[model samples]
Target chain A: MKKERENWVDMAPDALLGYAVVVLALVCFMILLAIVVAGVRILTGMGAA
Target chain B: MWHRLTLEDVKVIGHYLGVLVLVSAIGLVPPLLVAVVFGEWHAASRYLLTSGIFLIAGSGLRFLRVQPGRLSRQQALAITGLAWLVLAFFAAIPLSMSGHYANYVDALFEAVSGLTTTGASVVQDLDHLSYADNMWRFMMHLMGGLGLIVVALSFGLFGKGSASLFTSEGRSEHVVPNVVQTTQFIGRITLAFIALSTTIVTTLCLVKGMEPARAFLQSLWVSISAFATAGFVPMSQNIMYYHSLAIECVLMVVMLLGSINFTLHAEILRGRIKTFFEDTEVRITAVWLIAIVMVFAASLAASRLMSDLPAMERRGLFMVVAAYSTTGFQNVTTSQITGSFASGMLIIAILMAVGGSAGSTAGGIKINRLAILGKSIVATLKETLAPDTARITISYQHIGRRPVTPDIVREATTVLILYGTTYIAGALVGIASGYDASQAIFESVAMASNGGITSGIVVPGMAWHLELFYLLEMWAGRLEFVTLLALMIQLVVSATPSSLAMRLHARRAQRRRS
Candidate 1:
């Protein structure tokens, strides 16, 4: 591999990195949702709200 | 003359698109829930049609023949660009059909604004708008904030396209291997925040003697808006309809948090709270927030525009966040403040241009860019003073160390360039419609940034061209400037100069057709 700066226009690497981060965030967001839903379910069951 | 895509790419594209559609289908939950709660047939009809389109599209993609591996770069870009278009068009249909807008395009503009979390609106009478429609707008903002694809990829309906999807969604760091899992992580944090924040805010509103039903819905809607960095209001007058600082404060805190990337929240959960302080993006954002408040407050007081001193200070701060974060939730109109045009409106315009943190729902040039631009300036100045042999490197530290290489500068510069070009283009059109260039520029930037503070430029029955221009700007801005550019460039390059690219592309198409 040449030790050189690649073309800045190369969107491949950046795009891939961005996707990975997005997926991570999406997954994290869902888990948070699941937890909330479960909590809501439990609270409703307990007649808390 | 772009080459028609090979089946492999199409399959990959479809796979990701399937995910986007699937996620969009689920977005109808809020609208349908609203319909059921309010018993509004018209609104229900909109949700049903919209959700049905998404569901059908998702199913079609699911059934499409798909490649098993990750998506090609071009394929990912294609999927990401088309996903927003596909979702926005369908989302608009319900609103258009419900008689909110005369046509689907106007409806779509509103839908895109909501989904992109831009919070700009074309709809004039929202309070009287059916509950279903109102809920649908809030839902769009919620999904748009985390990103439509983030929802899709989280459900594992889409895999490889996550990279392109996330980029379009404007995240600087993906920081995870499994795209679905990452989306889930963000989702989890968002849900917790939404539930907790909503309950507390709702309780407060309920305690404030707001009607219980209104309190619940308001809290729900506000939390979603705050978390997603979307500032849309179900009521016609927005937060002003409530006229409660308590509500505004809750919303402001949520919106502020919404402007911060969830990655930071993840770090806090992991007990690495100091990472936030160290983050160049957060630090710069904090500095920007403080400075803008002071400037705005000074301008407000000095001009004697504020009859009430305390009101001025509170509104000055809230208005600053509302604009700078690109949340667009307004308690005070642009006309409410009295200051030199240089201080109030001008400062707000620049702040709107600054936008919120990357990866959050807020749009604009982004704090990271400003941070990098700042670093680059300092580095250059230092280099001028240093010995010729001094080797040095300094990158903007947002979520992590992002090298401020010439490459990074170019990317950031390109983003700014695209933003300026779009703003000017829209302004030129606005000027053509007989508006002042400065007013046009301000409105263009506000819309493009999703900041949503208008100086009476965006309103009902405006020049169709200007309205359309702002709509397109909001759409392009939400994609964070690359996907649209990539799509155009890809189309031109892949299709032109050689008849062979398309010829071969056609062969693949023919094979697929067979």
Candidate 2:
């Protein structure tokens, strides 16, 4: 049972790495979105006022 | 020494191009019929004049009596690039003649965008545009999406050069052994899907309180746009004009179908159901789409942009799917999209850049190249980590589990870099023209990947140089890079005199004496 557990742990990084990559991508996208939304709002608000 | 191009090369390219032009003229017929039916005599005359021009040019070239022969690789590439340019020129004629565009360049931009399935439009007052003219615009999407060369080949135009010409247009797979059969099969599948989709969308539109004539014409246009993944709308408000979820759902399915490789459709039709899930590019596309939707939904939710979870999911998923499929149908107006979805715009642009499956109407880096690049990355990592004696073999399922080779990796990387550089260059040009960086990059990716989703950068009266730049981007992106490179090389080789080397040598000798 312990050996099997160790085997699973050995396989975890590849799975973890995939998830990590996805999370990183999501974070980057969210940050970019925030910046764009903020920028557009400020620009449009200025134009309107 | 590089061999100089012979007169035969020009003749051969002209011969096939003439045949393609004639085939393109037939595309004008459907719009002409629509014009006559609608009693739009002026639009009909424009179509007639354009068709006549195509017929005359085609017939004159055919009269040259250039014997048909196998096209050398360079000639095939040249024809592939030149055919799109020539067709765009002819298509613009009718568009300009309609007086909808202020100038010829705007019409040409529309033609390029339409033919490349880029979906960007500069024509204002789209709601008031005549039905025949509207039909012509969407027809360009259908022809361009199916590939003009494929259409000509379907009519049994070229025999020996058909394969290379087909490949040059960015299609690599064949449904059948013969190129002509493959083209026909693709056409038949497209028609079948369009027919079914139009019926369904039209019915849904009627159920949603739209008038019968408007419903029918809009359904037809949307069906073609969806199948081509072209994202053109007869109405200026786009999909938002209908305000129907059923219509959006139907269009989403059609766009997904359009983005899938046609060969996969053929395989499924032939009872190879496993091929759909087993295919590498399709699998990557599926995963990529899910991730994008998740990211989009999360972004919308995090920002509290939409009023509710359902609204967020609906709008977010629609945009995600549209971008993934490279179909530019928008439920929101330009202002709402930029204002509300601003946070997610970059995500959408990235999805557009990744694009749909290869060998489909969609464009971008293509899921296949991305998959190959992914596998190559894994292979390199394994080789670096393993012992020196270890043989690291990487394989992925395409048609089969093909082993990853250096050549494949190099080809994928080269094209990816080319697309990336071109994308950045377009953005730089846009920034130089005084547009904001984010909007510029977004529009550049949209244009480069043939995604019609716009950020208001592409307008009726933009800088001519920028318009020309986007036009070239659409052309280059649609043909992928190799064909354009071949065309450039061919032009240079043909333009240079054979004695230029001798002249250079004489000049060098004189310089040394002096």
Candidate 3:
């Protein structure tokens, strides 16, 4: 059985969707950022070494 | 009949397309003038032909039969979708005709990039190009940056259906009672600033190191790019080409200002500027810039990427603002950046996807939409804690409204859906084109957000299919995706399925009745 549909009448109509889109896009972005962070960590480590 | 963009409320979408073409045609003049100054008659002549053709076609369509009635809601979506395609096609012809651009799709892609104020360039070498070509490329940012419809309405007014035309272009605010007047205000303010900015920045650059002539030219291009939030640098090496941190800092300041609404700028200029600080877009964007930079800085700190906190903080913050604003300017090369730097850049990709304030030259989901979403999230969280009898309210000011509405939320959500789906779908296609996952994803975000920067996905003189994909992505990005999807849905619905089904079903019902 399906859950009751939330009344978006009181909610910001675009917020959920906007959040979702941003999150999805952010995930991809964050992954790239993590990789950069790791690489920088390694490079700086080697430099000091 | 449709007139050019006028009336804050009453015109159809078709008129916006017509207005953009007409405005782009008119905008071609300055570049043509520049071409004359530089002695490139061939470039000037080709541009003249292109502009002439665009004007005739646009004006002709503007005069087409438009009944004085409520425009179909679908027309707004249709016009937005078709406008980019139409502009790209006509705009490309001149560049190709001038013999610089080899492929029509490349022409289309560059034009799309220019008009969307996306800074992506398929062109590799810029050193040999004549002044006219360079100016023309820069002018695309100017026209796209300020919005052609707003530009047209500033110089001219349309009767009756003006409001529809304005709404079709997705304008919600009215700075004046009449949109034409508002357009004039915006243009006057913009032109004044452009003059001041160009003069000051050019002199400063000249004082520092650049040749006077080159500085002047760069100033003109940077002024347009800054105002439009477009990331185009006249030189091939981008902002880094100058190797001047001062210039980058100056350009970044302008780009940030450009990302905010002109109305906000006006408010600040008028000295009633507290409104500017209070703006949801402004505050959120500030927070976003700070938060993203901190996260990356922390990530770098953990990884020990850059030894100095102040230096990493400055570069990280700069990249954050640059990406989020969709200006795509960077003083650093892809080669020098680490994987952490790539992450920081990707964060910028997400920020670009979020874009700038609405009713402005900047593109993406915009800060207000995010603001509204933030409120909604708070409201959701509060519902669990509040008593059943508690009367609660949520409010935020947009262009003019004090309390954001459910309708606004719905519209913003629909646009987000369109933007998200397009980014992912484009990435999938790029992957299909044999690009790596990271490159495909990065290019997808870049193209879909109208953020021009890629991780080697876009090669110089690319294949036609890939060029077409980028062109379409840029167009859809400029319109925020839903408008394009709405147009496609209209066509698909009109051509084959539902109409045929309805007709056949009606016949069966009639036979049953008989």
- Please report, in order, the local distance difference test score of every candidate based on alpha carbons: 0.72, 0.83, 0.69
Position B255, candidate 2: lDDT: 84
lDDT for each residue of candidate 2 in B258-359, tens digit (9 for 90 to 100): 988888776555445566668888667656765666556556654545634446646766787788888898886787667877888899899999899888
Candidate 3 achieves a global lDDT of 0.69
Model 3 DockQ vs. reference: 0.03
Q: How does residue B3 of candidate 1 score in lDDT?
A: 38
Give the per-residue lDDT digits (tens) of candidate 1, residues A1-49.
Answer: 1321243235345534543454354345433433333343343342222
Task: Write candidate 3's Cα lDDT for B1-514 as tens digits.
Answer: 2222222322345555676678668778987898788778898888888878998888876765455565455665566567667877887787766555667777777778888888887764666667787788888887677665566667764544456545656566767678787777677656765786799789878888888877898888887887777877787777767666566666666666677676765555444445666777766765676566556665545434454544464466557657777887765565444354665555666777888887777777788887887887787688779999986678886444566567877887888788888888888988898887767777888887877766666656876787788778888787766666667766666566657677679889999999
- Per-residue lDDT tens digits of candidate 1, residues B133-160? 7778888887887777677767776445
Query: Candidates sorted by lDDT, descending order?
Result: 2, 1, 3
Best by TM-score: 2
- The candidates' DockQ values read 0.02, 0.02, 0.03
Off by over 4 Å in 1: A1-49, B1-4, B7-15, B61-63, B175-177, B334-343, B396-403, B493-514
Model 2: chain B TM-score relative to the native chain B: 0.95
